[model samples]
Target: MGSTGDSGNGKAGWWCRRSSSPSSSSTASSSTPSRTFETRDPRTGDVLAHIAEADKADVDIAVKAAREAFEHGKWPRMSGYERSRVMNKLADLVEQHADELAALDGADAGKLLTLGKIIDMPAAAQMLRYYAGAADKIHGESLRVAGKYQGYTLKEPIGVVGVIIPWNFPTMMFFLKVSPALAAGCTVVVKPAEQTPLSALYYAHLAKLAGVPDGVINVVPGFGPTAGAALSSHMDVDSIAFTGSAEIGRTIMESAARSNLKNVSLELGGKSPMIVFDDADVDMAVSLSTLAVFFNKGEICVAGSRVYVQEGIYDEFVKKAVEAAKNWKVGDPFDAATNMGPQVDKVQFERVLKYIEIGKNEGATLLTGGKPTGDKGYYIEPTIFVDVKEDMTIAQEEIFGPVMSLMKFKTVEEAIEKANCTKYGLAAGIVTKNLNIANMVSRSVRAGTVWVNCYFAFDPDAPFGGFKMSGFGRDQGMVAIDKYLQVKSVITAVPDSPWY
Candidate 1:
């Protein structure tokens, strides 16, 4: 395992600190205890910035601000087309500052800047624009009943929402949770992960530029117990949206019930499976699986870390996967050529290492990279473990690292059984050329999203939420707005006096 360093004050020491200009200086109220979270460059361990922590009082203030904006501000009351204009302006601002946003995301979470710019930032902005276009398109339906009256339904905003984002893709998650919430005429209080909160705080400034009213989108950066728990359990908060571990998701659900039975949407953990059959295209499966686990250092919630291959082609797949894992360049996130960056922080790095050690102890063969490379930074080599059983910890648990556990299956039924063995039902992928097999496996898998030939494929127009323990409510698409609004039916009598 990697060495652990305690900063005495409960702060992670590896964070980087960057110099800030005078214009960036803003303080919370005197009553709120001011604390700082340091940001670090994962490649060099250099300080990027020290961001202020928003405590419970700060969360309260942010939520109150959002509530005030929703109830009284002009933002929620603006016409959908008018709101679309603001969203478009926000999209323009995002494009103008794409480089900056990518850089901040890279420095904060060690995501590849090239991919962050080419994929994450543009996709994020597009999500904003897509939801912005839909802002005016939210429609309610009229009921045709056997009565002398006419009835229609209205979808109205639920009120203040609290969005707690994970660290893997902080900037994207921020927009994914915030954009639609605002478009639905709901206010938001965001609590970004403490490990990577700088970019989210930076976004508060951007939201202001996008003409978002004060408190409509407020960001509070602090520990999960402090700011996150407060927001999830706050009685004034009408809904809570979270993306993180399953344990935390359950906690949030409990907190919501303890508060006001607030509407909750959770995109939680996954031990997603990727099955490659004998008839599948070997190279493409290898490529997709590599991208699935190694992208973002395999920190993604929907990472296809568990790969099951048919016995006839298992060796070929393993060899190809090992070679692909070796080619993943682990270096500074800022470098365009770098394919894999360091884990988000040291704790995460060590956690991944601990899991690798567990795999070794459980008699799983470590086929490829397992230890950290380079003298500095929190870089773990892309690890591949073969001879893994469905019962092994490596295959059952969510590692959230660049570790792939290879399991072999003899028949289609065995593969399906193993794939659906875990508590997670988030996402899964199947690689095969046979249409019958594809259709059968797709129907059998208990995941929310199943990819027939691809992995990690996402769109703003699609509804994404897990089935079982993975939690409830969708994040993107038209259904996402449903969680933020209430449905009410209005009935009026016709001019005919016979009904009276």
Candidate 2:
């Protein structure tokens, strides 16, 4: 619904304009150049939207606007009930336009429309409503002390926040960061990944419709180095929240330290494992494992890319997994029957392809798909590799594509050790019938989240995050509000107070 054209004097690229450009009579020169980052449909290579690329100047403008809104705008001082009303309104607006948003997401990121509608859209709206409901519930405490007057505590917003969202689940991540920050009375400047900025931009329009004040929520769609770095290091930004790779997470932390030492919350990469025990339900193990790797074309951060099965059931598990992968429909995301879609972009597609090559070169046996399927759209068939060593690149690194590596484990301890092998500890899965094994393995595996028999099960009320190199802090649930707020303790004393 925005203008998709090259606007600047050929110096910058095309930009998506939410409104018509200012009249020529209104201003002589604009400091921020209008540039665009073209988003292509992974299934058809069609131009989805020529998005605007916000440079440092634009980043500054956005940050300043958010800062002003936080410091003086009605949103920051608005009552919790009022904020909740606005957030609920926004959620309703998103629901009203769910179909269009899902279609746009499908075109922009090649995610299945069915999944987007049933899973993503409803989940996103619920997340907004969840956070909205939490707005008025944020409270502080009072402490009683020996030598002080009566006092109480106050929880305050952390000020302007900078959020860097990932390409996968762009809309979800946007609401995850924005809704909570808004509920906590913090204005934000969001930098969406260049690969999937359209839905975010569209959400911006919906935010306006929901009565979110101008400049209260500003989205800067651009490259990470430009808009993202600017948001990360901006002096006006009081906090930074990011969802991306660990490498970039480190960079963001370093930038925060170098700038104003802003509060930072990161949800980084993962090398999650699916441990299938000998006594596990074979059918359930096989089905969940296949969904873990092939779902979302295996672009999920918690995709069970590394599968470790007990040697007793390893052979049968691999056979069933291969067969399951074969049945996955990898084609047009818009098609109602399609289950999987193309990778987000060529860079990610090639990155996954390189990992496939690495798995082969490193002597890991390729059990199924190993090459690109078609010429158009960046499509890779669901791949499964067996006989994979734990040290192989494909086994360790985050391929972020439709690739799975299998290994055999002899015992519960072995499975735990193998599952915790990678530096990432985002999530893990365990499939077993024995409650003892489940309890032992669940405690043994060091991940932020563990699924007993399911994968990618998300609830708005549940807390989600990672541990170790997977990054810190939690998202969703009441815990998410902690990162967006600062606490101040108060003390109270009896009649005679020595210190006041």
Residue-by-residue lDDT tens digits, candidate 2, 317-435: 88888888888878889899987999999898899999899899999989899888877998999999988888889988999999999889997887888898989999999998899
Give residue 193's lDDT in candidate 2 (0 to 100).
86
TM-score versus the correct structure, for each prediction: 0.93, 0.93
**Candidate lDDT values, in order:** 0.83, 0.84
Candidate 1: what lDDT? 0.83
Tell me the TM-score of model 2.
Answer: 0.93
Worst 10-residue lDDT window, candidate 2: 1-10
lDDT of 1 by residue, 122-219 (tens): 88889899889988987789987456888899888889989999999988898899888878888888888888887776667666677765567677
Question: Model 1, poorest ten-residue lDDT window?
Answer: 1-10
